[model samples]
Target: MPCLARWLVLLTLLSHSAAQENVGIGLDLSVGVEGVLPSLARPANASRIFHGIVFDAGSTGTRIHVYTFIQKDPAELPLLEKETFQSVKPGLSAYADTPETAGETVRQLLRVAKKAVPHVEWERTPVVLRATAGLRLLPPKKAQALLDEVEVAFEESPFFVPDNSVHIMNGTDEGILAWVTVNFLTGQLQAKTKKTVGTLDLGGASTQITFLPKFKKTIESAPPDHIARFDLLSTTYELYTHSYLGNGIKAARLTALGALGAEGLERKVFESSCLSRKFREDWSFGGLTYKISGIPDGSTGFTECYKEMLKVVKGVIHQPPELQDSNTFYAFSYYFDIAVEAGLIDERRGGMVKVQDYSIRAKEVCNKLSMYLATKPFLCMDITYITCLLKDGFGFKDETILKLTQKVNNVETSWALGAIFDYFQNIKIH
Candidate 1:
């Protein structure tokens, strides 16, 4: 083979090996189940069968998800972290009876997938299975046996460990290219069009936004990832993505009441939920800043600090180009204001939730703003908001946003680099 071809082969092999090490899941896969992220760097240029099958033995039902990645352009079209999920009802679904049933489910899903994408080389692809919060809830022996049966049924590997990357708490938010905030921002500018579509992605644990232009494709991966991009309707665009950790519903409630402190505090998390331990320190999201103020030392452990974060993020909410009406900024601002009047809001005692509440009282603010702020990171809320924002906030209009995005793309000023510099300043790295 030619040198270039040989080099490509070598890289793929290396990447595959890396995949073996990186096979961890994340919070968005399910609630109450801790997720392990993949150690493998997201594929950038090759097409492969990257499948994730999840089994959550829950009180409600068993949930399962099967996703495949056609890595023709791994960097451009990675199977999203979003696609890695599905639910199963053990009593209702045949797959719940025995390992045999689970295997059958896999076979059935594969069959359907084959029909959808005939080019898939299923025989060579590897399938992976991991259980959620329920896994540990069951006796260890039982969990292991079930996992073993699942491994056998699906002809896949199973993992029982939870490795939360970034911070040691509130896990989730691994390698999705959103952490390189500056690059993510610059990439957005490059993807500018006539108008801007704000995406508010509210996940089980985190939230993010991706402003896309006309020439946008669904970006599935970020390789070498100095920067990140977004994909919409198979169109890819560089975007300014902002992510907030511990911003999900459960956490919202937990933090609201000052339950989850910095230490020994699980936050409003279900054991199987990936957000519990991942969100706190997940710096991998570029252009995304994860801030919470529930810490005791006015830090990431208490609700008071989180109230301040509400203040800090007001800048983003009130940014140029027409801020979203339903954004949390106003709610937080109003909540804080109320607390001040009632003398119940104290930044020192986690008593500012009132101030945080009223600031975002716009009737359709959160609902409408989701049109353009949605990214896959924020889970269910993200979907609702993004869908709502697109329909309501922008009134389902993309022409103006697309054109504006294109204009931003044309004006390249290295925002990402500047962001990095700003990051350094914040940290006093000099």
Candidate 2:
């Protein structure tokens, strides 16, 4: 089929773009959604380039990814040439009460996109914001309020705003897209032997695990929701993927302290064995405030902390039996950040580490709290939780090797890059 003809048919099904409302368009690529992004073919001497602006509305922060792609060959996938990235702290969910402020945050990030993308191309570029666990965990009304404000911001921008461009993203798509990002950048997608690695993303409010299962029993024994079948570039992938809500690092902290969803947090104090006995502080997450402290005179160490962390993971995360065998995985986001802090990986280059490395580091951090009190009060709890999540939650063996990294092939290893492919397939580049 001609490239123009393929996009015309896709645009018809995506006609909701004209409504300009905050609708949740499920890009369940699992159903083999075809390309909708325009293709431009020119003389061999001329080069065609296009841009995409994606806002990752995560729990801890909001980041803008301005991606520039060049179509060197009409017969091949576009090459990702460059990415201009910027971020702002305190995600949209923090402004749940004052929704207008959430809109302003997006507007602030738009300036980065404005500079990153050429002015002449502004009218043709498609801009979107996909809120993750942060907004998803918020109350329905509050989440909608934030999305409404963001939509208003997009409307005021110079860029093209597609229909349902601003909305909360489901976890299933989050995991699968992230997997696509890692595999795509590593050149695994085009290889003859499709030996792609799994992905593990630990955010502030949720964590996701996704991988292509090699054995038939892996898919058969899995829950129906855990299996996602999607086609990309004419290749079908049956992946085992799942995102654990309220199981992110920050949310897990509250659960370990017995503060998650607790009523009257203002009047009560939540204490945990995970922290030093002398530790006391106020923690804020998902727009709620809670006073948390450690036991005044109770024993504290890896043993006590591990017990608390285990409470949040045990029986909560489904352990795929196939994962017990050796398999490669690219762990990022919090996984990369914490690993760097624990000295298990290099801060710049990143490196490989076994699942047991986290446990060993967690024990060291927890056993010697005083050494890290000023700079890392929660390092003990945070690291221990990661250790528990991998072993007890996901059932990874101690010898399981994980490649921890912030980027692959110079592209930030994130679902944003994988997600932009859909927008590229849907929008007209001209």
Candidate 3:
């Protein structure tokens, strides 16, 4: 049999058996639903293919992920066949006042989905959009308006549009889903294993840290919302997860300038030690723009930048005791981007570096500010903040290693994949 045909047969069998076991199809927010997985039985045929479209409406950009999966057998999880990913700039938050334009962005990305999935399967492919901190930061009414606009676009698209498909995801759910994505893609969730790596996601408006707590004290000492519990593949996991708003690299930039949450942006010129002395720019975030520049007639360098970052991160972030010890963490998004720009990691393959490495690089970059200022002025601030965030904020020892990466197993590292998994298990039989 040809490769495609053989795979189809296997998938059909798996889907059939999964249906018989009452597993049902679709992703579920609640883990291990009752009667979800019973004893598997052979089906009449074994060839099934499905597709899921997930839009990550992040603070900085809106990204579309088209995922294809094939179920090989009832007893096992579906295998990912391929992924098609695309992104648009300025994020959905930028369209706060013009939600219709945000919806248009969604409409444009759906074209990619239209081309990726088979024409016959277009109507069957489920499409979902989950906005993160960007929309969450917006006024409730404005956020709802933007989501409603996106829903209208999804409804008009030639794909399966589920109810409540467009909404702002809570920070806790965001962290949990990202943890799932990293663990699942890294093969750490297979065979009921206990070993799992942690995840650190640095976005434009917020940052998330998630890991399984091994000690009871860690969970006991944590604030109520700082901890989350969920089950994946019949195993319950107690995870320490938190998303810090206004702490993302971009937001941190504002905080360092004393512009975050400040009123009357029109007359204010926020100064920071992070930028080059001569560097000045119009920075925009979360639907607001500001004039930001380095301290004029004042100091600018690693020392000054570190102090500015300290005010933004120190004592603002909860430092769990567990982080002091050695732990494996996968850092992505801005974490990966800055590392690659600093020549600390391979852009394509990624690489590992210790917490101290960021500190070292920040010093090197900040010291030679004039040389790199022409091209990447924010390099000094970004690296310095990341170093502070990992060390003083998260309480990671200087020796703690972080695997800076953009993707795992060729899949982009983000919560979107985990959201896809959740979407699949929740597919109702009706």
TM-score of each: 0.30, 0.90, 0.89
Model 3 has an lDDT value of 0.83
Distance from true location, Cα of 205 in model 1, Å: 2.4
- lDDT, candidate 3, residue 55? 98
Write model 2 residue lDDT over 79-154, tens digit each, in one string. 7899999899998899999999999999999999999988866766789889999999999999999999999999
Off by over 4 Å in 2: 1-44, 426-430
**What's the lDDT of the predicted structure labeled candidate 1?**
0.30
Alpha carbon lDDT of residue 31, candidate 1?
23
Off by over 4 Å in 3: 1-46, 426-430
Off by over 4 Å in 1: 1-64, 68-85, 88-123, 128-198, 212-238, 262-430
Ranking by lDDT: 2, 3, 1
Model 1 RMSD vs true structure: 18.3
Q: What does candidate 1's lDDT look like per residue over 1-430, in tens digits?
A: 3222322332343234334444331112222212222223344443444432233232123434333334344223232222333344441122232545545544444444344322323432333333332232334554455555544545432221122100111111111222222232334323433343343333333344444323223223222221344332223445434444444332343333334333433233211111122333321111122342212222221122224234323322212233323221111111222233333445333231321232232222322323322232222222223223233332332222211111122211112222222221221110
224 Cα displacement, candidate 2 (Å): 1.0
* Prediction RMSDs, each to the true structure: 18.3, 6.0, 6.3
Q: Relative to the true structure, how large is the alpha-carbon lDDT of every model?
A: 0.30, 0.84, 0.83
